[model samples]
Target: MEDEVVAEKTNRQVVEDEVAAEKTKRQALDSALRCLIQGQGGELPPNVAVGMNSLEGQSRKDGNT
Candidate 1:
């Protein structure tokens, strides 16, 4: 039926949108990691920000985690 086709199309569009959003999020995270490394003289690895325990703890305490 026509309604079934429309529903399939809508579902596909939703999946494609989710994929695009995830790609965008990855790109943004990459850019932020690049900035962090460059600003710190490229001395640390990609996920160094995650290893910043003190700041992370502070943020959690402040409810900004």
Candidate 2:
């Protein structure tokens, strides 16, 4: 019936959304790892420096720092 078709479509959409979300997460992790590796020149990795800079920026924006 039409109801069954709609249900199937909804399920497919959910799966697609989950896959997209996972891809985004993986990309972020890969970016962070690359930054960290690049940051390894000093006491902290490059990624840590980038992360701290972002965190500081966010805190400033929120008026917390």
Candidate 3:
């Protein structure tokens, strides 16, 4: 029973770590895209803007600000 409990905790920690890593990756990608847009004169291209908006909406739905 103790080993099983330890295993479950380890699995949960792995999942949490993966989620944190994913959030970090998402932030990095967002920063890179913003930098690219800024290099293009502070305006996001229409398609990119639409996609970003959709992603933001989904992020909000997922309880992330």
Q: Which candidate ranks first by lDDT, i.e. highest?
A: 3
Which 10 residues in a row give candidate 3 its minimum summed lDDT?
Answer: 56-65
Q: For model 3, how does the per-residue alpha-carbon lDDT over 1-65 read when each residue is reduced to its tens digit? A: 99999999999999988977887688689879998889888888799889887877876787776
Worst 10 residues of 2 by lDDT: 56-65
lDDT of 3: 0.84
TM-score (all chains, Cα) for each model? 0.64, 0.62, 0.69
1 or 2, which is superior by TM-score?
1
lDDT (tens digit, per residue) of candidate 1 on 1-65: 99999999999999988866765675567568767878988655535655654444754564443
lDDT by candidate, in order shown: 0.67, 0.69, 0.84
After superposition on all CA atoms, how large is the RMSD of candidate 1?
Answer: 9.6
Q: For model 1, give the 10-residue run with minimal summed lDDT.
A: 56-65
Residue 54 error, candidate 2, Å? 28
What TM-score does structure 3 among the candidates reach?
0.69
Give the per-residue lDDT digits (tens) of candidate 2, residues 1-65: 99999999999999988866765675577567667766885355567668866855764674444
Q: Which residue pairs come into collision in candidate 2? A: 35-47, 36-47, 39-45, 39-46
Sort all candidates by lDDT, best to worst: 3, 2, 1
